[model samples]
Target: MILTGSRLEVMHFVGEKVEGYMKEFLKPVETYWQPADLLPDPTQENFLEEVKLLRESARELSYDYMAVLIGDTITEEALPTYESWLMEVEGVNQADYDQGWSKWVRAWTAEENRHGDLLNKFLYLSGRVNMRAMEQSTQYLISDGFDIGTGRDPYRNFVYTSFQELATNISHRRTATLAKQAGCPQLSKICGVIASDEMRHAKAYSAFIREVFAVDPSEMMLAFEDMMRKKIVMPAHFLRETGTKIGETFSHFSDAAQRLGVYTTIDYIEIMESLLNEWQIETVTDLNDAGQRARDYLVALPARLRRIADRTRIPTLEYPFSWIA
Candidate 1:
């Protein structure tokens, strides 16, 4: 649905929705994720050495795949765009409030950069650039940048991160499977590690949003409805230089491959269901009339997603992203 109304009108309702969700959920579940173990060994020198090795390994594989995936340029074209977007949408625009958010983005970027680096190196070391196809893909992807609205809505940001993180995990896992199939155990191992990290990243957003749902179930439910209606995009969408192709990719998947991959709509709904159940969103007390309506609406999300999947009749391939369609 189009957000056709005045900005003020939109913000008013959205803000109330946010407030309600936060008061009822976010505030109540304010405890953050904090692990007690410092590192694998907890010895500073050994930890540092291990981290350095992991970083070096990741960098190598990242560049190797980047070269294979985007031609042998290694120009860091997409990095700048991502950095700019990160700066533009620093959650809620408060310097103070964004410290953690900023740090998270930075760390994620740093890690992601290594993926490109390692991929490029591997391609360079092993000669794998399909120049014409890779360059064309990159050009198309970069021509259209990912669009994050100017509203600086934190919850929207939250939603974006949650899905994107999961998408990345899915991508990495699939890449690993492909690598293993191609007889490269090393690449598969590296991607497997990266996929683990991506899973954690997804959990962070999922858990945080669960807290938001707790803070104000009514507002969160409404916000979720609004977000689902709008649909979310990946951060790399605008930077990959193949926006059209990427969209085509999604469309193709929707039409013929959704049931094939772990990223299918059914998978997505299941993740949401797991999260809501873990947070006990349905058990929250004293929901207002609006909240009740929102709850009823959410109750249909799984069925709706399943119906869409069934209607599409996309073949269910055993491996993620392995569908021919």
Candidate 2:
């Protein structure tokens, strides 16, 4: 993306494997479970009664849990921004319109499209969220877009997606666990499925990075280091509520997530650690001096991050979210 000649070549090389990766990572649309399968059907005879029961189960959920769920849903519902951004990446779309990279992005977006659909419908049935307010927030997030600092660089974008997918998997898995504990088995199952999808996607993206590291170790290492230096910003960093300024709602939403232990600083450090191990970063060799220093910074990063994480405190204050009223 930065006028690097090899970047486009590498993207083409990876694009060649799209068919295999698709088969391995993506489920067929016909066989895949749609949101309707997990949710009550409106056309069913007992649909009203089923929704009543679903609402009853949702009532048992904690306030923080509900808030975090709404935030996650909004983040997922802003899929259009992510898809558009990815499609514009340096080499992803420079090839044929029907190329593997384009197909992968579309298919991935299609699958991800269900996540927000399912969650939004469930929340609507739950009767806990202010749908109008929540919908407005989602619209704001998409309209506002975000600055994750990748700037169309495929290497940097892959790194961001790899970390993000794992983070979402963790949060969704935890939410699923809490949902089961809160006696909402249906929602728990829904989150479990979504978490599974995230895991598969994470594996796909991470594998792509692993391959890049093998061929372009120096550049790959530099990109990874650059991202860590930039501190991979979450996709929902621009999250805000109705009447709120840009990014004003993220702090409150993050606080709710931290308070609920759904997604926190500790979890963030763990994900970073896991990625380092997943990529075998410590073992990588053949780098230039700058790349070596970048590797060193990444090597000591987990401990440094842990110490910082230890000193930080999640705010004890609770804020009322407009989306929850």
Candidate 3:
């Protein structure tokens, strides 16, 4: 089915299948894991003992790890900004209860809400985070907001989410591995579950783009190219501390992540390569001249990025984060 190059129409076409996407990607809330499930229960008889154990394990975590975790938590806490932005996308009408796009956004938000909650609670119990400082940063991030360069375009929005979700998945997965290596199994489990959610969400967003490519190949290809050309800015790009300017904290946080190998330039290149493969950019048909050029640019982006990444060096200096006491 050829679309009129209307992104709204393409969104509606794909939104119609959101119910199936939700079923496949998002789990029923009743059965899904909650923050309390992974955390020490205040009502439990052994709560104090569990807390002690948690703190003990947390002590083994490196300073860089703590900084990265705090940054990740702050980013997740800015969900309100993300949801508000997505709800305003051209095809999503929050007033329409039956709008599939709106439903997907709400459901996705609900699932994502657990990530920050779980991480915040864990950090608090671990006695490693400066709760007040972290809370302030979270508030600043939400209030500061962000411009991810997607504007209100659904095609660009989905492409951004697809890339962002995969990036989060890599960071979380690596954090989990590092957690286990630090002898913090609880934190590892927490990061592992969150990573799983990210991967699932990534698949859903990628599927949306896949369906779009089917009906609006040229437009979808162009959108993909445009986002890559502008570069995908992470939500945490707006993160800040109490005395710091916007994005100041994020620079240090990013360096910590890079140093720890939790998330790096290599991961970014790999994500681009994965998306190119996932959408079969090289083989996509029905593209106009512009779309063909976009596809050519995208197909070559990973290699180009990797050569630059090879020369990039992670900062060896560690900035003293207010979030870490």
Candidate 4:
């Protein structure tokens, strides 16, 4: 199929395989795990006892860990923003359900919805969170939204999602390990399951990019390069507390994450390296001059980023977050 560098053409070509992607990457709703499965059930006779035990385990978690978890939960809670953004991509038409991109968006959103649900409920029951403040932050994040530099292009959007999902997987996996070390086995399990979902989602987006590269190598390569040059910003980059300025809270939240080694600069560079490897950017052929230049820049970015990361330092000071009690 000769694509005329039309993003719509590429997206349409790839959208045809959405069903197969869903089958391979997403779990059926009925069989998939729900937040209720991991949380204390209200109707059970032992509900109060379970709640007590949950709180006791939560007490073992560190302040920084709690802050990072709360930030992650808020990011997940802004699902509406993400869904709406993807729906607006060039080839995705929410009204045209027959065109598979919209279906993929809805299905992907459905799977992602559980992440926030599970984390929010756990934080509320944990007795360590200021629920009202956390709720306020979530509201703010959704309202503020974010501009991740994709600008309605499917290729750039897929690249952003691919990177974001991998980053989320890393942070959640690290949190799971930390939770277990803190003796909070239940929380560890929650983070672990969420991390598993993220990894699957990452692979799905990465696959989409790989498919695009096969058919429209030059344009896809250029898109990948543009996003990397702009830097893939997180969905929660605009996160702010109730009275704080836009993005003020996120800096503190990020510092807490760095202090805990949940997600760091090194992880960002490694994700880039992994994507270059996964997409086999080095050996991609049939690229025009600009595309080849883009490929070269992307290929060399990881080593350059590593040098900057080595010189950078994370602040040791802890900032008090409004979300924590």
Using all chains and alpha carbons, the TM-scores for the candidates as numbered come to 0.61, 0.97, 0.99, 0.99
By the TM-score metric, which is better: model 1 or model 4? 4
What total of clashing residue pairs does each candidate reach? 41, 0, 0, 0
On residues 167-255, what C-alpha lDDT tens digit does candidate 3 reach at each position? Answer: 99999999999999999999999999999999999999999999999999998999999999999988899889999899988989999
Kindly provide the TM-score of model 3 when superposed on the true structure, using C-alpha atoms.
0.99
Model 4: how far residue 271 lies from native, Å = 0.4
lDDT of 4: 0.94
> Whole-model Cα lDDT per candidate?
0.50, 0.92, 0.94, 0.94
Total clashes in model 1, counting residue pairs 3 or more apart in sequence or in different chains? 41
lDDT of each residue in 183-267, candidate 1, tens digit only? 6655666556656666766766676666555445555566665666565554443323333444544343332324325356666
Clashing pairs in 3: none
Encode model 2's per-residue lDDT on 1-325: one tens digit a residue. Answer: 2224489888887788888999999999999999999999899999999999999999999888988999999999999999999998988883567899999999999999999999999999899999999999999999999889899899999999999999999999999999999999999999999999999999999999987887778889999999998998889999998888999899888998898888999888889899999999989977888889999999899899999988998888887898885
lDDT of 1 at 147: 71
Model 2 / residue 301 / CA error / Å: 0.3
The better-scoring model by TM-score among 1 and 3 is 3
For model 4, residues 1-325, the per-residue Cα lDDT tens digits are: 5477688878878888989999999999999899999999999999999999999999999999999999999999999999999999999999997777888899999999999999999999999999999999999899988999999989899999999999999999999999999999999999999999999999999999989988999999999999999998889999998889999999999999999999999999999999999999999998999999999999999999999999999999999898899
Clashing pairs in 4: none
